[model samples]
Target: MAESRPNTEVDLNSWLPITASRKAKWWYSAFHCVTAMVGAGVLGLPLVLARLGWIPGIVAIAVAWLVTWYTVWLLIQLHESESGKRFDRFTELGQHAFGEYLGFWMVMPQQLIVQVGSDIVYMVTGGKSLQKSLALITPQADFRKTYYILMFAAIQLVLSQSPNFNSLKIVSLLAAVMSISYSFIATGASLWKGFGEHHVVHYGFRSTSTVKIVFDIFSSLGVLAFAFAGHSVALEIQATIPSSLGNPSKKPMAKGVTVAYLIVALCYFPVAISGFWAFGNLVEDDVLLSLEHPNWLISAANFMVFIHVIGSYQVFGMPIFDKIESTLVTKWHCTPGRPLRLVARSAYVVFTAFMAILLPFFGGLLGFFGGLAFASTSYIMPCAVWLKTQKPKPWSFHWILCWISMLIGITIMTLAPIGGAHEIIVSWKSYKLFQ
Candidate 1:
């Protein structure tokens, strides 16, 4: 019976989205991590810097990069923590640490929010980038953003039919390339504008009001936190790599993460520093938007951003697709087939697209969702699980590190939403939906 149990479980997971196959290589991890990490979030770093100023902004990005890297390493280690028992999903790892029921409740909600919220943000990103590109190409061609969002949703409705994570290799790779391409373009444009003969940049903070500055700082933490959100899907990504006693997934995963972080550092610092240097406190919420000149380059950069977010949408959406489909089959006894995927995934794309069209406050959405859920999954949950399961000695280095990371995560989770909500309300005062 014990041997039979293992076969049965393997058969079940064989049809699931995340665990359907395990043929991915180390380079798969590299680009997938890149596709996951460097999405719409990086474009907003300049705005975060605008709120934070030079010294604090640089420190904040550096600290966030280090913190998430450490916590993600912890998550990768926990994936196979139990000998011969792999926790393929974040929820499974949570179950190991906190027990089944508490783990499900603790991790599921936060994971869902991170996944679904990311899709929504990606929808907004794709649409806005598409809009920007089109507007630049044809200055007189005016169309409502609502139309562009639906067009983006239409593409997702088709691509969301991809069977599993392994099937998205090409898309993810292109996205990784696109991310690097646009980051360089934005950086180059910013550097040019900064050194242009008419440069008139101010290095002051975005606001002078102390109260507002505090809230903006809190909100900026969420923005910075959002950039490190690849941790939320770390376990799922590693689950794609084949594992055995002789060759563990962690070795390759760590290698890939190192490569991904180097790419992230290269993409992040140049854009943030260059954009802020170019526009100073006057930088737009998205650095790309601030680069108005060199119309052809900015337009191509926006198009690349559009393509990248398309892949990012799938990288984030695949897990949610797995959850929804697996739930219907396991609990409701619905038959799994093309019909199930077609309906469930199309419905999801439409839902996120609608929500994005309704709000479409890019920076505000990042801050709100970043604080509300991204902080928990990316920063807090991994460290908390490490402490719970590893049982490191009290006041030891690992113990103290987890505690400190959890505290910072808690701070971001509590305060960022208030700041984000304030920004949303301020935008709402004169804003019209679907405009």
Candidate 2:
């Protein structure tokens, strides 16, 4: 008998089939990846770069990029080995690669900590933007708490019922365009206004050394990593793409991941640099505030922030929802129907809303979440999985190097929040106003 050829058509109805074309896949993957990048870091980068200077900031970003790449590669390798698919839920990959028990525990903290934390950060940022925008119009109105509640409900409604992934592609594309457009506008406005003319000279590893600067830069590394923390989304994107691009190989998926990360870094770096250069020492928690432009630009950026939060909610919420549903159906024998999913998702929304209300100070929450929640998901868990699964294959020098870097990344993420913990506590006390 003649050898049979493999079927190239990716079944869209199947849960794990690669169904999108290469070009479409790349674009979609880039959208999610960049959205994750711009979520928290776009606002935080200016302060870090102002203190650390471009050199250290760039170095930290480079380290973050490396960590992101390795983490994605590990995920792809594990996914290929077990499910013959790309990673979607952390638990799915975990179960296949490790086993049920280990995967359950491994994914449990990630669902509670990283996923919920990301949602809280999104809601908090949205609340801050709402407050700022409202203050401009109805100066006397205290709408922060109301805005938070509304946003939480709105996001929950959208996420409770699953959305077409293609809609996400559109949202992601618009976000990327808005991010780039505002960045260019900000850069142009700063240049036209001569924002960098009165630049303050701050010494880093070169000039007069201060403990504060060193700590800030080190802490900023953690922040940067958190900013670049969604490489797994790239894997999901790849899984969504048609596997005919490399049906029997993982190279196409790897390429998609690499391209996605690079595009995100490109879009992010300019915004960070320009925002810092414009605001210098007086930079606010959100960099959009620093743009010296017409009211329209600021409004557009604010709206973009809202859209970005919606996208973030989807990316963060989906995996968490999937994990919760899986556990209920498989372990507890609860039916995973639409009603049950809604209930699970509603519970998450309520919980995240409570956190968002309790932690209204955007900057403090960003740092704390970056150090604790984002750190574990982006750095710690991936590293742990890589270490566990890639064993028996002798550890090469490169592997050792990656392990060392992972440790450093984890340490920075763990300890960086100490600098801001007191402020977060203080803000919690004052959060009642927002509540």
- Compared with the true structure, the alpha-carbon lDDT of candidate 1 equals 0.90
Clashes of each: 0, 1
TM-score, per-candidate, Cα-based: 0.97, 0.80
Instruction: Give stretches of model 2 more than 4 Å off.
Output: 1-24, 82-88, 95-99, 133-142, 145-149, 163-167, 192-219, 232-239, 242-249, 392-397, 429-431
Candidate 1, 280-359: lDDT as tens digits: 99898888988878898999999999999999999999989989977877777767777878899999999999999999
Work out how many backbone clashes candidate 2 has: 1
Taken over the whole model, the C-alpha lDDT of each candidate is 0.90, 0.61
- CA RMSD of all predictions: 3.0, 6.5
Residue-level lDDT of model 2, residues 71-147, one tens digit each, is 76766665555445555456656675578988867766654665677778787777666555555455586664657
Runs in model 1 deviating more than 4 A are 1-8
User: What's the TM for model 2?
Assistant: 0.80
